[model samples]
Target: MASLNILMAQINTLVGDFEGNTDKVVACVQRAVQSHPSPVVVFPELTLSGYPPEDLLLRPSIELRVAQSLARLCAELPAEAWAIVGYPRTRDDGLYNVAGVIHGGEIVAEYSKQSLPNYQVFDEKRYFKPGSLPCVIDIEGVQVGLSVCEDIWEPGPTLATARAGAQLLINLNSSPYHRGKRGERWQLVAARATEAGIPIVYVNQVGGQDELVFDGGSFAVTAGGDIAAAAPNFEEGDFWLQYDSDHAQAPFSGLQVYPPLEEIEAVWRALVLGVRDYVNKNRFQGVVLGLSGGVDSALTLAVAVDALGPERVEAVMMPFRYTSQMSVEDAAEQSDILGVSHKVISIEPIYEAFMASLEEEFAGTEVDTTEENLQARCRGVLLMSISNKKGYLVLTTGNKSEMAVGYSTLYGDMAGGFDVLKDVPKTLVFDLCRYRNTLGPCIPQRVIDRPPSAELAPDQKDEDSLPPYEVLDQILEMYIERDMSAEAIIATGMDRQQVQKVLRLVDINEYKRRQAPIGVRITKRGFGRDRRYPITSGWRIGD
Candidate 1:
């Protein structure tokens, strides 16, 4: 039996760092050659320019840099093995997302991606022209097919390669992580393999970009739609598989399959990776957040410490007139337990100064939510000032439910460099808190048990203005994610008036969400890129 060794190099790449990305590829290739003789190395899509370079692809200098990087790879790549890598290619027609095969220190074959995903966080159509044909290459007398990330999702590319007499398929990817996305990928790849009647090797990139985190759960499936091997998610490494050609009927064997992560663990790891990469890549000294001993802030603090450690995290408790004694005590306790730098700052003086300055403008009007919002703005100003002075990124703790109903005050509680829970719902917030406690008691028991509140007004609670989170989250998931109308939501045994009110809040809050900081996206439709609605639209639910 002739055995073929294949290496899947799942790497973390920085956007537009051509030299650095190339260096990583060269180093991996050298290591692969030293460890395994005559192996075919596969890397993720656009490994050179990183995934979704956004408008960086439009720059002219990017083309030159890519060319230079490819040249360097050709010179430095080990000649003992074959390598498959992804990058952007410039042709007379237009630019394309391409995968190239390298052997004997030269480019051997190239495959342009046929499917261009333009929805959600992807804008590939804005940059590249799609290819119409499939690419098949011959490696040591074995026929192999090539596909990019989106190519296998559709039917044509993989089928075309199969019809072209390929024995195996290698798909390179930069697919991002969302809840249950790993299972979806496996099912899709399994179907593709079965339809093509050939085994597949799927390699994906792993790391965090601005708002996207690629969980490298790379794997392979046999032609019979059985998973042959699987790599761990949220990790970076080289996963190996051996294909025995001598057993022509059953070439895939001796697979190493890693277990899948549960929903809570997967979401937690994604948040940690996203926060860590954003801070490290942007070169922030550390992170700081206003802790109110609430579930939201507590979860944000825990995520920050886990991402960068306690030494890099600072917790500030800003107390106003409405602040509860329990909140103060709990915040201090959590800080002590986590060993983070904890400080207590009173916002009363700042609020007083602001009210005095606005007395003349507010002479005829009684106090309303304006005063409540002022308290939040005072804390926002303090946090931002600290961030500016100490090079710390302020982590805002607003959840999806508040952001949906405009419960968050823009430039007040919404002010920060990054939001750790922007896409997380309120119910999920409680669940994640409980999950964190299972690891250890990082969050206070009282905080988790107590009712949620903003503490900006006297005896304020979240439910006083909005519906219960359990009800609110359901309506939101239906309307925002599933695109159910207000009438449709009401049909599910919800009150018509309540449904209308929730929908209206979401519609009016578009402007606020437009200015909100980018956060980790854990769902199919996040506010930033996935769900884009016009702020000034006249379209209403029943219209």
Candidate 2:
């Protein structure tokens, strides 16, 4: 039986660092050659300049940098083994997302990505022209087909490659992380392999970009739709697979096949990776957040500590007149448990000063939400001051439920460089807190047991201003995520007035969401790139 060894390099890459990205590719190729004789190393799509370069592809110097990087790889990569590297190729018409096969210090064969994903955080059509032909290359007497990320998602490219007489398919990808995405990828690859009557090697990039985290769950599947080998997700490594040509069907074998993470754990890991990469890639000193001892802030602090470590995370409890002693104690307890540097800065003095200044102007008017918001603003000011002085990124703790209904204070609680739970709803906030505690008791039980509050007003509870989170989250899922109208939501057995009010809050809060910071997107429809709405729209529900 003739056997072949293939190496999948699942790596994390920084965007626009041409030299750095190329160096990583070359190093991985060298390692592959050293470990497996005559092995073919497959890298993720656009390995040269990183994936989703966005407008960086439009830069005048980007082409030159890509050319230089490719030249370096051709000259320095091992001569005995074949290397499949993804990059951008310029043509007379436009640029193409291409995967080139390099052997013996020269370009042998190349495949351009055909399917350009334009929706849901992808804008590939803006940059690359689609390729029409299939690319099949000979590797050690084995016919191997080449396809980029989106090509394998649809049937055209893989089917074309099969018709061209390829025995195996290699799909390079930079697919980002979302809940249950692994199962989807696995099923897609298995089905494609079966349709093409060939085995497949799916290699994906692993790492966190600005708001996206690619969990490298690279693997191989048989023509029979069976997983032959798999690698760990949210990790970087060179996974090897052995394919026996003699056994034509179900040939690939070897390597550990790690199970997919459960939903809560998967979401938790995504948040941690997203926070870690954003801080490290942007080169922040560390992170700081105002821990209000509520579930949202508690979870944010825990995520920060997990991502940046206790020494790097700073927690501050800004107490106002309405702040409960239990809130203060719970905040202190969690900080001590996490071993993060904790401080208590009373906002009373600042609030008093602001009220005194506004006394003359407020003489004829009654105090309202303005005063409540001022308390929050005072906390924001203190947190931002610490951020500016100490070089830490302020992590806002507002969850999606609050952000959806305009429950958050602008320039107050919403003032930060990043919001850890921006896409997470209040119900999930409690779930995540419990999940984190399962790993370890980092959050205080009292914090989770207590009813959620802003603590900005006397005995203020979140339910006092909005619907119950359990009900509100359901309404939000239907309206915001599922794109159901208010009428449709009311049809789901919810109160008509409640549904109307929640929908109105979401509609009116578009301006606030527009100004919110980018965070990790765990859902199919996130506020930033996924779900886009016009802030000035006069569109109304049930019109």
Candidate 3:
């Protein structure tokens, strides 16, 4: 019986860092060749320029950089290994997202990606011209076919490749992580395998890039639409699979299929990876966040500690006249529990000075939200000053619900380099806080139990200003994420008045969300690239 050895080079690459990415590919191929005989090594899509190199693909120098990297891979990689790599290829016709096979230190076969995704965080149609043909090659007497990430999502490319006379198919991917994406990939790929009548291998990249995070849950499927093998999610490493020409039970061996991460668990890991990469890639020394003894900030603190250790995390509690003693103590307790640097700063003196400066300006005016916003601005100034002096990235703690309704003050709680829960809704915020506590005593129980408040005014709670979170989050999800109209949401048995109020708030707050910092995207649609709305538009609320 003859068999083929395959290695999945699951890796994380920096965008536009051609030298670094090529070095990783060469090293991966070298390590694979040392263990297996003529092993087939597969890497993720856009491995050379990194996934979604975005506007970097527009630079004229980008063409030269990709060519040089490809040349270097052929020169430095071992001749015995057969490596499949992905990069952008510039031809006279146009640019293409291509997968190339390198064997015996030469380019043997090339496959251009056929399907270019253009919706919801992807704009590939702007760059690459789609390919219409199939690519097949003979490897060690075994016929093999090739496809890129979006190709396997549909039936046409997979069927076309198999019909081109292939016994096996391999896919290169740079698929980003959203909630429940792992199961979706498994079911979709399995169907593709059944349609093609050939075993399929899927390899994806792992790590974070700005607002996006790839989970790297690579897997394989048999011709009968069964998942034969799977690598773990949220990990970057190499795994092996074998294909046997003659076998009694199954054609593939070394099966290690594991179930997907539970929904909340997947969200937590994605948040941690997103934060770590954003801070380290941008070269920030560490992170500093205001500890309000609220659920949102408490959850953000725990994630920051888990990502970069406690030594690199710092917590500052800014107390105002309305801040309760209980909030002060809870913030201190959680900081001590996590073993992070904790400090106490009083914004009273600063707020007093500001009020005194504006005393004459407010001579005839009655008290309103201006005083509340002034309190938040005082704390924002303190945190930004600390960031400037200590070289730390300030992490804001605003949740999606607050951002949706414009309940947050500008340049106050919203002023920071990054917002950890920008895409996380308020109801989800409480759920995540409880989830983190299951691992250990990270967040204080009292913090989770208390009614949420901004402490901007005396005896004020979040519900006092906005609808209950249970009602607010649902309406926001319908309008912002699913694009449902106010009437549609009301038809679902929700309060019509509440739905209209929430939708109006969301429409008016586009300007604030536009200026907000980017954060992790764990849902189907996030505030950053996933959802775009005009800050100034005459569009009204309707069907």
- Sorted on lDDT, highest at the top, how do the candidates line up? 1, 3, 2
Count: clashes, candidate 2 = 0
Where is model 3 poorest over a 10-residue stretch in terms of lDDT? 244-253
| Candidate 2 Cα errors over 4 Å, as ranges | 541-543
Please give the lDDT score at residue 472 for candidate 1: 94
Off by over 4 Å in 1: 248-250
lDDT of 2 by residue, 127-197 (tens): 99999999998899899999999999999899999999888899999999887899999999999988888
- Cα lDDT computed for each candidate against the true fold: 0.92, 0.91, 0.91
Q: Model 1 over residues 154-250: C-alpha lDDT tens digits? A: 9889999999988889999999999999999999999999988888899999999988999999998888888889989999998888887666556
For model 3, the superposed segments whose C-alpha errors exceed 4 Å read 247-249
- TM per prediction: 0.98, 0.98, 0.98
Clashes of each: 0, 0, 0
**What is the C-alpha local distance difference test score of candidate 1?**
0.92
Candidate RMSDs in order: 1.1, 1.2, 1.3
